[model samples]
Target chain A: MLSKKVILYFILITGGIITLAPFVWMLSASFMYDGHANVYPPRFIPDIFTLTQYEVLFQRLDIGKNFINSLFLSITVTAVSLFFNSMAGFAFAKYRFKGKNKLFNLLLSSMIIPAQVTMLPLFLMLKSVGLINTYMAVIIPGMANIFGIFLIRQYVLSIPDSLIESAKIDGASDFRIYRSIILPLAMPILVTLAIFTFMGTWNDFLWPLIALTDNSMYTMPVALANLMGEHSKDPELMMAGSVVTIIPVIIVFLALQKYYIKGIMMGSVKG
Target chain B: MRIRYSAPYLFLTPALTAIFVFFFIPVIAAFVISFTDFDIYAINNFGTARFIGFDNYKALINDQLFWTSLKNTFYFVIAAGPLSIAISLGAAILLSSKLVRLKPLFRLTYFLPVVTTLVAVAIVWRFIYHPRFGILNYFLEFFGINPIDWLGDPNWAMPAIILMAVWKNFGYNMIIFIAGLQNIPEDLYEAATIDGANGWQKFKKITLPMLAPTTLFISIITMIGFFQLFAEPYVMTQGGPLNSTLSIVQYMYQEGFRWWNMGYSAAIAFVLFLIIFTGTLIQFKLQKSPEA
Candidate 1:
């Protein structure tokens, strides 16, 4: 019985360590000096730690500029998308309209058509509008995703129609009722959706890679990927860049994890 | 109850407009462009585009790179998809056990990989899979096994990426599985115990049947997600080692972005959509038939 218990514990702990080792090693190697990380037997911990790689990243490679670009893009995307998605979501959930069910189902069915299908022509369309290499190229496409609208609509459905009706009876305007009543009531889910949007935009890779051709406008993931091409030999430097790319997401995840997890459950059950 | 029609339309305008311009417009545009011989020349002047109806799709049927990518993507989905589901089921079963303690800790540990940024983790795994100096090779030496070139070798590259992907993703399905497990009544297990059934019998007779719906859901979602295999290959291998790890999306990116063969790339994207659409429909049909 003791042996069985020990075996179970062993399996669980080993699995945990395997899941975590890459992240641990990434953090460790980020502090290692040049050529210090490429030892024959990989070092789990840096024997002589240094901040030079981070210095090189921020000062020489100018990752700070890219970092700011990523932050600005994520914040802008999150803020704008949340507003757009919530407005549409609330309308879909609460208001009566023609072809509502048809439109909603159409959008839902289209979810299976992966976003990659749109890339080629989307790029050309953005180029035609002279939006390529600008923040708008990234922001415009992500402004109101179907999934975001779906999530927000699900949350808004639980909201009582009486509240909106009462506000209407009180002579409140549509925008006024949305702002004063619906927005306040839906704050929790809005916060949850905000985290989702922010993390998604911050960590987005492929779209940003295709859209943002200019290095000056590159997000952190795109920049890190490009950096990997030139600095493949410099593991320490690459680790530092990875750290920069991942830290914001980790921080945001830690802060509002409940919402993130809840969002996953919501998506799973509904989807 | 007397809501104005225009109010709802006004509320939906921003999202609908954004979706139309960015999503629907591009989709229709991609279909249109796929019929043309659009290439780098078309980028400079739209007049350079010639109507070459179905030629791009025809070309794809013979393109070696397209076949390689489709094969690679299939290799990834088939190998990784079931392995991921199996691991998640195993972990979920173990954690769902009455014998287990510290459940939340175990759950959180398993789930850490799922929530972490994939691009960042891919970079970390790239180093971990390094042939000469990676920890993976060092660990293999202890078991008297020779260090195999994980990413560097053509034969091993796709498998290596698959392994890393399974590890990164299994946690997500585990969470879903745990929820499914919790939804199963304790009464069924109790009845199995009363019949003198051992653990394996109890799990086989009771748990498996109860979890069928959840299993189906997991499979479809996992299947959908795996079809979008892009970042792992992009970061770790750059679809390297004889292009063995090159996925469909990566191939599309190469055609569209790298070579600027927009028409050809658009055709590849449409093919992916067709595949995913068919797969999704099949899964739903199977799900419906089971109930019927």
Candidate 2:
């Protein structure tokens, strides 16, 4: 029994280190002076913790612009998507309409079609509209997603009809009921969907890479990829750039992980 | 004027309209474009696009890069997908065990990688796989192994990407597996014990059968996700060291976006979609067959 316990702890500790080492090394090396990282024994701790790497990233690389771009894109997409999707979801849940189920099923079935298939023509369409390299390019396609609507609809369905019926009996308008009753009741799912959308948009790379031609308009991931092309040799500075790009996501995940995990479970159980 | 029938449509009009205009239209356009020869010349002027039927498909057949990318993608999915599932399941079982303490801490630690940005982690891993100054080679020296060029060597580049992918993804499925494990009734274990079943026998006969549905779900989702391998090699190795790590998606991206070979790229996307769809269908059939 003792041997088994020892073996379990051994395994857990070793696996934990393996999972976390890259992040630890990244944070540690990011503060190391330039070229101070490329030595034998691979410094896990810097001799001197300097902010020069970040200074270079902000001052020279201008990653701050990309940072703001990522922030703006993530927040805007999340807010806009949540409002639109929740409205559609509320309609699906509470109201009866002709061809509603059929339309919803069609959207659900099409989820299997990978996003890449639509990306090519979408790029062309956006190009024709003169929206390339604009925030609208990223925000427009993201404004409505099938998964977000599905998630909100599932949550909205669980709310008892009596509550809405009471609100209706009070002579509240349909729009007023949705705005006051539904929005507050659906807060948890909205938070989950918002986190999911933000994380998805924040971590997104390929589409943003294709759509945003101008460097100034690039999001963090796109900017980081560009940095890799031009600055592959600068390990410390690259680590700093990575840290800048990843910190917000890590903050968001750590803060609201319960909702995020709940979202995943909800998505899998139904989907 | 109370609860008018048009309310639902009014509520849904904005979202439905956006999805229809943006998503549905683009998908059909891609299929149509795939049947034509749309390239840089066509992009310059829409009228220049030619209706060249089946030529892109024929060209893909002859294209060495497409074949290489497909082979590499298969190599990654086949190698990485099962390994990830096994690791995730193993971790889930251990964490679910009553003997384990600080389960939440362990679970959170394992799951941290799942939420981090893939590009950032890939960059961090690139440094970790450094030939001369890497922690991996440093640790390997204790066993008298020489430094290995992980990202630089074609032989090791894909393996390096696979290792990083497994690290990044296993935590996700681990959470799902934990949920599945919790759903299993504890009485079954007691019943198995009363029958004098040993640990391995209980696992084989009881746990395996009960977890089949969850396993099937995990396998399908993981396979579908793994088939879209792009950013790892794109960031870490650039599918380099003789294009050993080049993926189907990456090839499509390069052809469609980089070179503006929209028609050919669309064909690649459709092929990937078909592969994923067929894979999902096979999983569903396999899962149902055991019951029947």
TM-score of each: 0.96, 0.98
CAPRI quality of model 1: medium
Model 1 segments more than 4 A misplaced? A1-4, B288-292
How many residue pairs clash in model 2? Answer: 0
- C-alpha DockQ of every model: 0.74, 0.81
Candidate 1 whole-model C-alpha lDDT, 0 to 1: 0.89
Candidate 1 on A1-271: residue-level lDDT in tens? Answer: 7787787888888999988888888999999999988998888899998999999999998999999999999999999999999999989998878999999999998888889989888888889889999999999998998998999899889988888888898899999988998889889888888998998899888999999998989989898888888988888888888888888888887788777777777777784
True contacts kept of each: 0.74, 0.72
Tell the DockQ for candidate 2.
0.81
What is the C-alpha RMSD, rounded to one decimal, of candidate 1? Answer: 1.8
Question: Native-vs-model 2 lDDT?
Answer: 0.92
What TM-score should be assigned to candidate 1?
A: 0.96
True contacts kept of 2: 0.72
